[model samples]
Each structure stands twice: as C-alpha cells, then as structure tokens.
Target chain A: MKLATPRRLILPGLAVAVIAGLLSLLAYPFPDALEDSLESHRPETKAAEEAGPRPSSEGSEGWSAPLPDYSVPGVKSEGLGGALAGILGATGTFLALLLLLHVLKGRGRRGPNG
Target chain B: MHIPDGILAPHVWVPLAATGAGAVAVSARAARKRLAEESVPLVGLMGAFVFALQMVNFPIAAGVSDHVVGAGLLAVTFGPGIAVLCMAAVVTIQALVFGDGGIAALGANVVNMAVLSTLTAWAVHQALRPAFPNLAVAVSTVLGVLVGAGGAAAWVMLSQPYGAKFLGAMMVTHLVSGLVEAAVTLAVVKALRASGLVPGDARVVAR
Candidate 1:
C-alpha cells in the first residue's frame, strides 16, 4: 500500500477545511436538545441530582482536549480561532487517521505477501 | 448527536461503550478484508472530509443545529464496514482532540452516529436501490441521521428529566436535518460517481 503525498492529500483537505472553518462562523451556538433538556431538570430528579453534583467543570474530571469546544486557545477572534481550530483539527485528523489506515493496510499486505 | 460529559448514568454510557468497541472491532476486520490497497487513501480522505463537514452545523430549528454526518455517503461509497470505521474515527477525533463530545459519552456517541447510522443506511439503501437509486440514496441518508438521533434521544431520556420535550425537540429538528443531510449526501454521491472516484465495484460488505 502507498500513501498520498502531502500535497495530494493536504490540498483537497485544506480546501474543504477552509470552507468549513469559514462557514462554521455562522453556525448557531445555542445549547442543543440534550443540553437544554439537561438544564430543565425537574425537582423530582432526586435520583439524578444525588448521583453527584454536576462536575464543576465539564472536562475537568477527565483528560481535557487541547481544543476544548473546538476553539483555539488564546486567540482574540472567536470566529477566526474557531476557523483555525477547525482547519487544524481537520489536518490533524487526516494525518492521524491516515497513519492508522496505513498501519492497517500494511498489516493486510503482510498477511499475504510479506 | 454530541452527548457531553456529566450526563448519562454510568450504567448507560458504559454498556454503550462496550457495544461501540465491539462494533468497531467488527468493522475494522471487515474493512481489512474488503478494502483494496489503493483504497486506504480513499478511506482516510473520506474520514477527513466527514470531519471537516461536521464542523459546519446547520440550524434546523429555533435553538438547535445539526451537521452533515456523511454516514450514508460513506456507506454508499465505500461499504458499511468502512463507513462505521470512518465515522468512529471522526467521532473519536471530535471528542479527544476537539472536545466536541464528552469522554464518558464517546461510546454512546459512537453507537448513535457510527454503528447505527451506517447499518441503517446500508440496509435502507439496499432495500431501495432496486427500484430507484437516487431515492434510495436520499432515503438512506435521511434514515441514517434520524435513527442515529433516535439513539441519542434514548440516552438523553435515561439521563435527563424532560424526555418528552427532548424527544420532541430532537425528532422535529432532526427530521429537517435529515432532509438536508439527504440532499447533501445525494449530491456528493452523484459527484463521486461523475468523477469516478468511487467505482461501482468498490461498495462491499453490508456489515
């Protein structure tokens, strides 16, 4: 199995990422159904409440992601930061997953021809 | 459907995680068997594309927006096996790298978005393709999102108090989101066909 060149892979990925990054600026930021519903907790939910207080911070209890909530760290422009984060994320995903697929493909090749 | 942390009982997410892991293993095996050497890049690129598209969330109602999952498109283009693998990767990345989803809830997210969506798409497409290929694509794409959302709603009802409202909101918004997802999925499938990026012979393995 062969891999695509950085240019071959990155170019198309960048094109898509840039558009997505830019367009994400317009995405509605309101809480979704799950979040909204969670907030509308009924007083009757003694069971849920007793499970434990909502974690003081959502990701604080676990391994925190570098780009929490898909936003870039220390960027003044929320929109631009989110855009850059999206671009970075797409590129990172491509490289990481490509590596994974590369390994899997290599294993497949080795099984028969190695 | 992104289920954040601090929601869902341990009993719920834990089992879903196990199920997701099993499904991922099954899909990975299926992928290695069906995927050709050259198609590795295709799967990688398709995963990246799905990741990118998911960032652009479209508002489906007054308060909520949904993103293009590419679940149906992936299943249609690559096969159901690869589709599951690709989406599992996409969702994992979104959670671990972007924090778009919660760590505890990742499995439930996968169960909803990856396993269910891909399988539903594959089945619906197979059932509908004999009569109308385009309609099959449309319906499969729509069903993939809707059914996946149903999985999400189930988890929410278990964890949260407002099941009726949550179900209502998710279903109504996702119904519209599903239609948009269908249109985009159909358009991309057509483009892939026209460009000969996805050959007819490549679609393999319903699982």
Candidate 2:
C-alpha cells in the first residue's frame, strides 16, 4: 500500500484523534494528579512552607504568608484532560479538512479517478 | 509544551486562539494557491510521518521524555504554509486523541509550535539559501528545528507564570529534542534527494 493515499491516512488519523479526545474528557475531572505531577519539585514552595513564620521589625512590616486559598474562580486541575481534548479536536478538524480538500482537488484534476 | 487547561488564564488562551485561527486560515489559503493534486498526497503523508515521529520519545534529563515537534522539519521539507497546516493537524490530533495538550490552550499551542516555528524556519531558509545552496537542506532543517523548539520554550515562559527555572527547564528539554529532530530531518531530506523523490529545486518541493 502506498503511504500517500488519503483514504489510507484518514482512518488512522481519525482513530487517534477520537481516542485522544475521549481520554482527555476522562482525565478532565481529576485535578490533583496534574498539580502534583507539575509541582513535584517546587523547592521554593517547600522551603517556605517548612520555615517558621518570621516576626517583623518595628520599622518594617511583619512578614505574613498569605493563606492557602483554592477557591479561585475557574481554576481546575484538568491539565492532561484539557491537552488531550484540544489535540484531538484540532487533529480531527485538520484531517477532515485535508480529506475534503483532497477529494475536491482530485475531482477537479480528473473526472472519474478523483 | 502541550500546556494543559488551568495552566493559562482564560484571557491568554482566548486571544491566542484567535491568533492561531487567523494564522491557520492564512496558511490554508496560501497552500491552496500553491498546491497541486500530486502534491496533496505528499503533504498528507508528511503529516502522518510527523505524527509517527512525535511518538518516538527520547529521554531528556531525569525521567522526562521529550519528542520531536516537527514544525521546522515540516517547513524545511514542505513550505511554511503547508508545514503550518500539517503541524496544526498533528498538534490537534495529539491534543484530542492523546491528551497531550489541553483543549483550551490549543490555539496557543498551534501559534507557538506551528505558526511561529514554520515561519521562523522559512525565514532562516530564505536567508541562508543564497550563501549555502548546496547545504540548504541541512541548514534549513537545523534552523527549523531550533527555531520551532525555541518558539515553544518562549511561549511557555510568556504564557505561564514567570519563573526562570520553568523557562530554563522547557528550553533545555526542547533544545535537545530540537537537535534530534534536526538530525532526523536532515537524514530524511538527504535520502529523499538522493532517491529522486525530492526534486533538485528546493522551491519545487516547497511548492
């Protein structure tokens, strides 16, 4: 089989895109895994958390660490999920477009073969 | 740099999406103008080849695995417009089917990896083509890979929260990946050229 045929190429591309999209959707709901993976080596955050609170001097304001707030609006953990969805969606669109364009061009080039 | 959702604020993603859409549109139009029926299959095949190449991940420092982001390679093999189209397709597939990048950040990813890298590589090819006509293929391949990886690193630094370590990590990982991609691209181009699959004229292949 020739590697350059549109019919042969589209199926695999579509299959991959669909599988990736589904996986992303499944991964979206879980946030903790992503955060933990991305932040496993935050030395600064670890150091700050470990050190005791420091008192402020008379002239200088006292050092106070902000409270940990996870309530920021629209913030969600779905890192892997989002990436998967975006890639699949875009890939599907691209493959479909390529197939359509190829068919159209093929038709224009040859009456029956196209 | 497949940035997942929640990494970037919505404001950043939205604008990047718009920019990416515009760039893709322009590239499609350009491709339509230059492409012939015979070239279509080659472009599509190259896209698949890129997808396959991306799957072969090489080990970066520690246990992290990085793969080829073939924006530069595509541009060198095809033209910038076709390369952009091909990469956009690859990235889309990677994001949707593989969960490699976030859906919301698709636009940013395309812009950074596809548009920026292809255009940069093309520009470098144009500049160096005159001086090193014989080495155009190798030079273009190297430039494309380096610029594409560099563009991704830059985008990650700018879009995400500021931190030198983060940027440094991205750059280091991608730089190694880029070199590997460059070597692969050079080998492919050389083989194609030697086999008579690619014509002597660079512009002809690009068209």
Candidate 3:
C-alpha cells in the first residue's frame, strides 16, 4: 500500500479552521449549564454554610489557565483574543491528532488500513 | 460539558482519570488496527472541526446555552474508537490549552464527552440503521448527547452535593441542545457525503 498524504483535505481543513475561528467570535457569552446552576445556587449554599460548616468549593484553588477563559494574553479586544484562541485551538487540535495517528501508525505494520 | 477545575472532588476525578486513560489507550489500539492510512487526515480534520464547532453555543432556553459536542457526528462518521480518539484530543486541548475545562476534571470530561457519547451514538446508529436508515443518525445523535450529559451529571453528583434539581435542569437543557446537535450533525454528515469527502464504498462503522 502507498503511504497516504492529505493533499485533498488541506484546503478544506484550512477552510473549516478559518470558518470556525471566525464563528467563535459570535459564540454566546453566557455561562454553561453547570456554571449557571452553580452560580444560581451560590447564595443558598452560602446561607447554609453560615448555618453549618461545609466542604470548600475550591476544586483547584489558585490555579490559572495559560489562556484563561480562551482569551489571549494582553489582547485589548476580547473578541479578537477569543477568535485567535479558537484558531489556535483548532489548528493545534489538527496537528496533535495528526501526530498521534502518525505515531500509532508508525508503531504497527503498514497495511491498506494501517 | 467542560466542568471547570475545582468542581469535582479528588476522589471523583482521580479514578476517572485512570479509567479515561485506560479507555483512551484501548481506543488508540483499536483505531491503529482498523483505521485506513488514507483516512488519517479525515480524523484530524474532524477533530479540529469538532473543536471549532464547540465554540459556537446556541441558546436553547431563556438562560441556557450549549454548543455542539460533535461526538455523535464523529461516531456516526468514523466509528466509536476513532471518534473517541478525536474527541479525547479535542477535550484535552480544550482543557490544557484553552482552559475551558478543568485540568483535574479532564478525565471526567473525556469519559463523558468522548467515550460515552461516541460509543452510545455508534451503538444506536448500528442498531437502528438497518431498520431506519434515515432517522437512525438523528435518533442516535440525540441519545448520545443525553447519555453524555447524564454521565456528566452523575459524576458531578458523586463529587458534589449539586442535588437532583441540578441533574433535572442539566437533562432538560441538554435535551434542547441535543436537538440542535442532531440538526447540525445531520447537516454536516449530509454535506460530507455530498462533497464526497467520505468514500462512497467505505463503511465507516465497520472500520
């Protein structure tokens, strides 16, 4: 079997990444389900805690993401930072998956479906 | 759902990490054995596509919004093992790089979003495609989202005292989100077929 190249998919993949990056700018700016629920229940949880001791809500206290909340560092514009993060994430995912698959394929005997 | 860090207890995430790692390893082996060398690019592209799609969240209710998980789409396209790998990669990136999800909760997110969702969707599609080819994907997509959401809720429940109210709300919100997910997945799958991105002779499931 011949070694495979993604020549045909390159353009389409780039198109998808670019489109996704642009669309990310339009992503809804609202808390997701878990966060929303937690936020809504916060006051009640606080009141209950005032009444009795409870476990802390801190799962990983003092931890910060490299790109916290998907925004780029020192980016003046929130939209621009988010969009850039989206593009970076999409491109990174593509390369990471490609690399992982390549490693796996390299380890096995080459075949038509390997 | 990207459960942020500091939500799940160590007792919950640690075991899930082990299980998720084991599952990923197994899926990697299966995908390596069955995936066509030529199809490698498709998997990568799909993974990227899924990651991008996740950024766009649709408002399903007055105050609830959720994005397309895309596990159902990948599972229906490339079978469970490959779909799992692609989703695991996407989720890992979202957690580690984007910080959309908790680093400690990565395993739970992977198990919930990738493994459960893909396997459930694949199984549903395989079971129903023979009898109802047209509706199978749609049904499977919806069920996959529900199962994934349920898994997330269960994990959160085990770790926190979120209570049944949170679970109920999560399911209801995800029900609407699942419909949105189904429509998008169906459209994408149709486009993939129409564009001839996926080979006509190829049976994505068997592989």
Candidates in descending TM-score order = 3, 1, 2
lDDT score at residue B175, model 2, on the 0-100 scale: 64
Share of real contacts kept by model 2?
0.05
lDDT of each: 0.77, 0.58, 0.80
What residue runs in model 2 are displaced by over 4 Å at the alpha carbon? A1-100, A103-114, B133-146, B149-160
B82-191, model 3: which lDDT tens digit per residue? 88999999999887777777778889999999999889998999898888865888989999999999988888777666677878877888888898899998888887
lDDT of 1 by residue, B132-191 (tens): 889999999989988998898788677655457667767777778789989998888887
Any runs in candidate 1 off by more than 4 Å, and if so which?
A1-11, A37-60, A112-114, B200-207
Q: How much is A54 displaced in model 1, in angstroms?
A: 6.3
Candidate 3 to truth, TM: 0.90
Better of 1 and 3 by lDDT: 3
Per-candidate clashes, comma-separated: 0, 21, 1
- For residue B3, what is the lDDT in candidate 1? 81
lDDT of 3 by residue, A1-114 (tens): 232257867777877777666877777778776566555553246644453212232554555567777799999898888888888888888899989998998876766455
- Top DockQ hit: 3
Worst 10 contiguous positions by lDDT, candidate 3 chain A? A48-57
As for candidate 3, its interface RMSD to one decimal place is: 3.5
lDDT of 2 by residue, B73-123 (tens): 677767787788878877776665555566776787788778877787778
